[model samples]
Target: MDRSNAFVLVGAVGAGKSSLFNVLFDKEEAALKTQAVVFETGGMDTPGEFFSHPRLYNALIQTVSDVGTIVYVHDGTDRTCRLPPGMLRVYGGKRVVGAITKIDMPECDPDFAERLLRENGVNDAIFRVSSRVRETVGPLKRFLFGELSDGPHACGDVERKKA
Candidate 1:
């Protein structure tokens, strides 16, 4: 698996995208509010405005154009699905997946978030994770980097497994 191409994380505001980005890259520093597209090793962290505002969709599109994978992060506690219709379909050339973030929160309903992602066009693997929990991040990392023994790498059209 080529780990050189970055994976972009997109989601609504306060969805824990940046936190997951830090975890994925093993960054010990605190994740601050993402005001714009921030490029880092292995992944790209995007601001929530790009995903939530239609006018900024172009920015989101441009940000992900070069990435090999697009991980759509969703807040588990947020019941609403903010994905515009066919928005993710635009990235036909990239691998699209879903991550229900902040699942460790007491009010988080990962099941609902998963259902919302499915209904919103995320047909790939959907992982339930908490950025602060090391255990939860491992599966996602393996899935993203293709470290799983069952498949070559996730960038390939591998079998979709729910995490």
Candidate 2:
């Protein structure tokens, strides 16, 4: 897998997206370095920051298309399962993998995660994770770097696996 491949982290506020970002970049403590530069093996630009604005979804889709994979972070504690329309439009029907964040929290619900994804039209590999404990991130990383490593593929394989 190319190291320079771009991976977008999508999640609600305080969902530990930044924490996963720090881990993937091998900068567990590097979040403190505001001016730090990230390097990728594929010679692609460093990963971009997460954006909630609908206007930026188009740009993000273009960026993801140019990259290798995307890591979508979902807050397990959030019951509404509400996804940003821009995100749904950008990632819908794509091979993006879902990662449930904040598993360390007492309120986190794994079952609800499946329901949330189903309702949000996310029919792909969903892994429960905790950025704080560093658990489940490895599987997520492997999945992102494995089957999802390719750009623009059918989400059917992932959906069938879940089914």
Candidate 3:
């Protein structure tokens, strides 16, 4: 797999999209209140505002087509889902992955977030992770590195079995 093209991340505000980028790529870019699209070495972090407004969806779609993969992040701590059902199908041209962030938060329920992601069309692989701890995201890291298979194992429930 080509590692040059970046992975684009899109999600609701405060969903830890930027933080995930930092954790995935080992960067210190703070997930401050982002108001516009921010590009990094391995990922594209879009503002939650883009998800809040419908007009920006076109821009998101365009960016998704240009990337190697699309990562849709959900806030595990927030039960309320901001994305429409099966939204991943919209970016069918690119690989789509789901990530449940804030897994370590007080109110987080990773199982619920995982279900929400599956129901919303994260067809390739779904990852449950806490961006606060890089090691907790091993499955996702492996997948990004093309070392982990994009099968049921990508759910990040069990440890990846050796080939």
Which residue segments of model 2 deviate by more than 4 Å?
Answer: 1-5, 30-51, 86-93, 147-163
Q: How accurate is candidate 2 locally (lDDT)?
A: 0.56
Assess every candidate by TM-score.
0.85, 0.67, 0.82
- Candidate 3 Cα lDDT to native: 0.74
C-alpha lDDT of all candidate models, in order: 0.79, 0.56, 0.74
Better structure of 1 and 2 per TM-score: 1
Per lDDT, what order, best first?
A: 1, 3, 2
Residue-by-residue lDDT tens digits, candidate 2, 81-132: 5465546455443455677776766777767776777677666667777666
Q: Which stretches of candidate 3 lie over 4 Å from their true place?
A: 1-5, 150-163
Lowest summed lDDT over 10 consecutive residues: which window, candidate 3? 154-163
The TM-score, computed over Cα atoms with residue i paired to residue i, of candidate 2 is 0.67
Candidates arranged by TM-score, highest first: 1, 3, 2
Q: How accurate locally is residue 114 in candidate 3, as Cα lDDT from 0 to 100?
A: 78
